[model samples]
Target: MTEIESATTPAAAHRRPASLRDWLAPPIPGSALWGWLGPLFVTLFAGFLRFDRLGVPKAVVFDETYYAKDAWALLKFGWEHKTVKDADSLLIRDGSDAKIWEDGASFVAHPPGGKWMIAIGEAIFGATPFGWRFTAALAGTLSVLILCRVARRMTGSTLLGCAAGLLLAVDGLAFVTSRTALLDVFVMFWVLAGFACLLIDRDRSRRALAEKVEDGVGGSLGPFVMHWWRVAAGVCLGLACAVKWSGIFFIAAFGIMVVLWDAGARRAARVRNPYAGAIGLDALPSFVSLVVVGLLTYLATWAGWIFKPGGWGRGEVAGNPLLRPLEAMPDLWRHHKDILDFHNGLTTAHTYQSWPWDWPILRRPVAFFYTEPRDDCAAARCSREILGIGTPAFWWGATIALIVLVGVWLVRRDWRAGAILLGFMAGWLPWFVPAFGDRTMFLFYATPMLPFMALAVALALGLLIGPARQATVHLARHAPSANRRLLGSAVAGAYLLMVLVNFAYFYPVLAAKIIPYEDWDARIWFNSWI
Candidate 1:
């Protein structure tokens, strides 16, 4: 038989490729229209949910008292100014009171990136509850869009990608964080953006390596390519850190992830001494891109503090040994020390503060707003609350799914599973250490992990739905049979429907709609939830 005939034979078609590069080839293509349209539809739906009745509860909720005021101060002045007594009631009762704010600066624990973002909304909407929260809603909506695109790239299925986006859009924690003028939402947005950039970099780098090898320009050792996507990832991570210091964990985790990806790419290219080559060629540049660039970006976020005089910690350094080197910039050193001290010394007990381990299990959620009504409602008594809890079905299901993914990574060596785990760990593991300390933490700190949890659920569903087993001329497609595919797809669809129903059931409490007391009690599954 001729070479073409031999290649088309059934036996030959069943044979796998020997090269590592061939095994790591790009995923099969799917419908082009659904790729973008699916994500857009989900994002629009999320936007509606987040923006509707966003101004309700007109009073500041939870920590919004701190962040909202800080944001308004940042908008008016360059730094946060101390607010007068009863500022929350003052802001709610009297919209036009410039005198409510005191002149002196106030100490802030977190970085300025999130407050700066809130300032943009305050600038446009005039510092009301809705005004302070507008940017968070926008960021949350954008996160859905980003996750859809990232999931599509990771799973090679537009349907599954959109599924992930939809899951995140309806998640209660995501909605709550987005609607509140808190820093965690910004941290979630930026961390997810950075992870998406790294995904793009992985695909681009692998393709480049393949192309170089195929062109016969080089042998096993591939050319050192300049990856701009990695730089973008670094910038995103830096912005994440600027928003919240906890984002530093993601920076560390993702930095290691990308370097390992480089080594894997080289090994797939059959490069001799791939590990050493990766270290010598890729590691240093990766550090400069992710770590050094991130540091500079973080410093840039302090421009408002650096240039303005009389901001908190702008003077009077205590002459600490470690901070003395920064004495030349007294304001910078003092500000850094002050923030460090505030975070480390925080031991104030809060009723809603939860342990980190409890976060994944939906325990002890923070109540952002709540009210009991006697006459406003038809019922004898009614409850209105905005609870920062996740959709239990999604969160609990994802915990199990993530555990399965660990096995998938170990046994199947699936890169997607590994990536999902890395994303989840980056957001979660750091908080576990702080849980042992006196510092108060809440379940909403798990906000950054929610996207990864959604991704994990999507991936698990994709596995259940099986592949689209199209027939080829040479080989018989026995696995992923038509009946099997149909059954799997149906099961996956049913699960999604269940998630939608759960979200609907909990929507009242999440959005703070007044409901009969008994109805509110029905939604609270446990005493801890109450």
Candidate 2:
């Protein structure tokens, strides 16, 4: 026998052999075409769910009032302009743009990345409901495809990857956010893309390390490697930050995470002083890729405001003490500080705003659209509403699963579990720091974290189902011995079914379907939901 085969054969004789290669490698092997087909099919289903009746309730809903109008202004003026009185009625009802806006820049709080995306849709379809929301729907659909591939890479199981995508597809928060012209959905998409890029970097780097060791070139420390995937991750993360300042948390968290991954990889390759090597070789290049590259990409998103004149807060830094030292700098630098000041000074009270601690428990969901359709309905009373609440069974189950995942990571040091937790923390925990103040946070702010929550639940289900049956085992002899696997699989299947059923039950409220008032009331499980 070959040396490597001989080393593993003794363990294989007693039980299924355990190795880093087996743990990290793809679980199924065959045609790459078949591998992509499953995720593609799931993405199609997600598209249908998001695109059906997308222009319904043809009016501005919730924050769509601010973002939709801003997007249209950005398209026309190259910067956001103040709109005229009753702009919502003029745009949605009258469908007229004549004299709808005044001739000056508006002080938009958020950056222009998401508004620019919305502008693409508006430019194609005109300034209507569908036009404003088209890009959001597209981003949301693409997020499913991205999550499917990422999950597939992490677990090595195409089935589990599609499961993660399917769960995210039906999630009410993900669905609602996508159908609206809001910034949060864009943030979710870019953050998800960044995570997927990092996963690709991990696999590629490990393969290169393995090849080096097999040759005579392996040394006490692992070889330094080039990572195009990490650079791609930086670009995605920068776009995420340009969409919302909150994305900075992810950039910081993921920067540390990729370096730690490199250190762990070196240790797995039996390199001496693995941590030291990771810092020496991988740290500097990774910083340039994620931090420096990300910063430049973020600045590129502001080209509309940067190159043009009369943008809000542009050229207004003459008397400002903090910005005086930067008089030699461009107007864009002053505008950035103004945007930061606007965010820090926001203490406005809002009815539906909830704390971060309340998000995991489904407290204080935002009502995007609501109306009583008495005249058009056959019943005595009917209601149509779009509520941004998550699927109860899925969110609650994911909460429990995340706690368990932490334990798994601590005890077993599973990199997959650790990565999921890091993603959840990056999207979630930062909101708590601002929540302690007077910031007007809402439950929908948790939209970016929903994919990670779905991933945790899917990963837990994979563990419950256990490994596939050995091909060499005799069916009759192993049937009785395999009861534990059978039982675990049954339980996992039942749980997934429950989540599916829960989503179906809540679909009417989520999609703004007109239903009897009694039916709508039945779906509202808590008084707070109303």
Candidate 3:
């Protein structure tokens, strides 16, 4: 056995009971195709659900008006340009004479990266529903795969990885957000990829520590660098930031999380003054590899705007003798400053806006598509149109599971649990600060956080179904109550069934497939949901 394996093996043994301790490291076979079938199933299932009727509701749903049209503009001009009113109608009814943007420039909030993505679909399929929402569906489907990889890596169990992927696949919010043409899914995919990369780094770093200790291979070691993996994470996070500024929260959280892992590693390695060694060796290089590289990548996403002479804010500094030098500097630099200001100053109140507390409870879900029906129902009925609500059972159950993880982390100091919680906070909590003012943020923005929440819930579920605790082992012999263990397993299984059933119950609304108004109302359990 490798030295590192020998060293960590004992800890794994201690976690198991004396009976199973001899086989502490279970033999994980190398049936690569069979091993990955679970994650692939999850991905294909997510893909099928997302791609079904993807182009329906044929008009511009919430935010699609901006992104869809901009996507078309981007394809034509290589950058987003302003559109005239009623552009979607014009684009839909035979690609007609749409107004092209003049040299004056149009101001916009958020960055250009996501719209650029939407343009790719438009280039292939034209400015249609399928064209706009294609990328969102693809990203959402891929997130399930990434989550599976992450969970498998963390838990070392294919079962738990499949469980995590299944949980995310059934989430109503994730379902709705995935079907829509929005930037958040892209952000979620990148952030999830970054998290997966960090988890990989953790595993590799721990292995490296084990090797050092096993060989007594330590004493002021040089910077412990894994150049390619860290660089890949930086690139992914940079793309995330380009999608939405909320990604910055992830960069900070994951950065600190990894550094702390380093500290723990040094301690594990028995390094004298491990923190000092880590700071001098790992910190600065990591910052350069991750943060500096990420920032440059984010800037490069604005290249089209930089090159375009008539893009938004492109000529703000033009014509004035004093402003000539500033304008000549770079169009994107000026545009970025303006975009930043717009994001910071956005405190306007919105009707469907809700608080973070309301988020966990799914109190105020934004209805992305709603209609007052004329005569589309059973009982001479008035039907309310519907879309943009979270899966009640999944999210509510996840809240309960998150509470359980807090206790698990406190009692067991389980590093995996802590990592999951860190991701949850990074994606979900920071929005509350911006949410303080009356800004119009929807529950869909919470999409980025849903995977972590689902994972947290899965971790809790894993604990319940996992190997019996040492204390509980006596029950198999002394207590003479097989009923109790059976009951516990039954309860956990029932909860999983209920979550899936609930997801199915809400799937119609989530995908915005037209159903009876009363059926939609039946799904809306809370007044705040409307």
Model 2, C-alpha of 382: deviation from truth (Å): 1.6
Off by over 4 Å in 1: 1-28, 93-97, 217-221, 315-330, 473-478
Q: lDDT of each structure?
A: 0.83, 0.82, 0.73
Query: If both were scored by TM-score, which would come out higher, candidate 2 or candidate 3?
Result: 2
Q: How far out, in Å, is residue 200 in model 3? A: 1.4
The order of the candidates by TM-score, greatest first, is: 1, 2, 3
Model 3, 162-271: lDDT tens per residue?
77888888887787778778888889999999888776776666666655555556566523545356777888898899889899999998888777777767765557
User: Lowest-scoring 10 consecutive residues by lDDT in candidate 3?
Assistant: 1-10
Candidate 2 stretches with Cα past 4 Å from truth are: 1-31, 315-330, 471-481
Ranking by lDDT: 1, 2, 3
Once model 3 is optimally superposed onto the true structure by TM-score, how far is the C-alpha of residue 459 displaced, in angstroms?
A: 0.7
Candidate 3, pairs of clashing residues? 371-385
What digit string (tens of lDDT, one per residue) describes model 2 on residues 1-530?
A: 11011112222434433554443332344347866999999999999999899888898888888888888888877778898878998878755678888877888888888998998898998888888899999999999999988887776677778889988998899999999999999999999999999998998887677566545454666678788999999999999998998888999999999999989878766678789888988999999999998888888777666556567866444455544434424566777888888877777998888999999999889999999987778889999999999999889999998998999889767777888999999999998777787788899889989889988987887777655544444322332336766787688778878888898999999988999999999999999998
Best by TM-score: 1
TM-score versus the correct structure, for each prediction: 0.92, 0.91, 0.87
Which candidate, 1 or 2, has the higher TM-score? Answer: 1
lDDT of 1 by residue, 406-497 (tens): 98899767777888999899898887776788678889989999999999988888777665544554333433666777887899889888
- The residue pairs in collision within model 1 are none
> In lDDT terms, how accurate is model 2?
0.82
